[model samples]
Target: MKIEVSLLAGQQLKASFADHEIISDQSISAGGNAEHPEPFDYFLSSMPMCAAFYMRKFCQQRDIETTGLSFTQEVITLDESNPYKKKVSMKVTLPTDFPKKYEKAILAAANTCTVKKVIQATPEFEVELVK
Candidate 1:
């Protein structure tokens, strides 16, 4: 999958992936960012969303009925020297009727979220500053 982002103007950006489009601006506290979600938020959001995606699929495959699902993700930076590096914790909430027998399996499915796997596996990328 490929995503493309283009700068629209000052503090404004646009991103496209497949059939979807996203617009973002700087934050009011940080500056003027339109009504769009910040990049950092997306990073944090990806984890829970990914986990939820896999969880839903896993449940469906197992004939489990998921009445509801939600998640909260928090990131803690252990070292200020490396601000980009941090650890994330996710709290997942599911419907009360979710089967107790499937708890372990569901948790395992959450662990397989694409974003979780990416963070844990630490894939490498090459960075180049272009003029």
Candidate 2:
């Protein structure tokens, strides 16, 4: 996928890919209006969001009821010196009447998130300036 990103007013940024346009901004204290989610916030959410998407797909495929299904995630930094070193603790909450047989299957389904897979694979980045 090719995503084009460009700077917007203040601390805001815009990313365009295909037919989608995503906006990111800094916090109020960071000279931005705080009108949109910060870019890093999106990064922090990608994992759990991706997992939730997969979980929903799993449930939908089985015609399961997702009326009360939910998920939560907490991002914990391992060290203040290096923010990159961190852990993501995720919780899956199923309805009280949910089928007990799918307990482990639901977790396995969530684990199928592409973002988590990519993170586990540890992708490398290459940055260069264009003339």
Best by TM-score: 2
Model 2 root-mean-square deviation: 0.9
Worst 10 residues of 2 by lDDT: 39-48
For model 1, residues 52-92, the per-residue Cα lDDT tens digits are 88888988998877777666788999799999778787877
Q: Please give each candidate's TM-score.
A: 0.83, 0.96
Candidate of highest lDDT: 2
- Per-residue lDDT, model 1, residue 61, is 98
- Candidate 2: which pairs clash? none
lDDT of 2: 0.93
Cα lDDT tens digits, model 2, 21-130, are 99999998999999999999998789889999998999999999999999899999999999889989999999899899999999999999999999899999999999
* Backbone Cα, N, C clashes tallied per candidate: 2, 0
Candidate 2, superposed: residue stretches over 4 Å from native: none
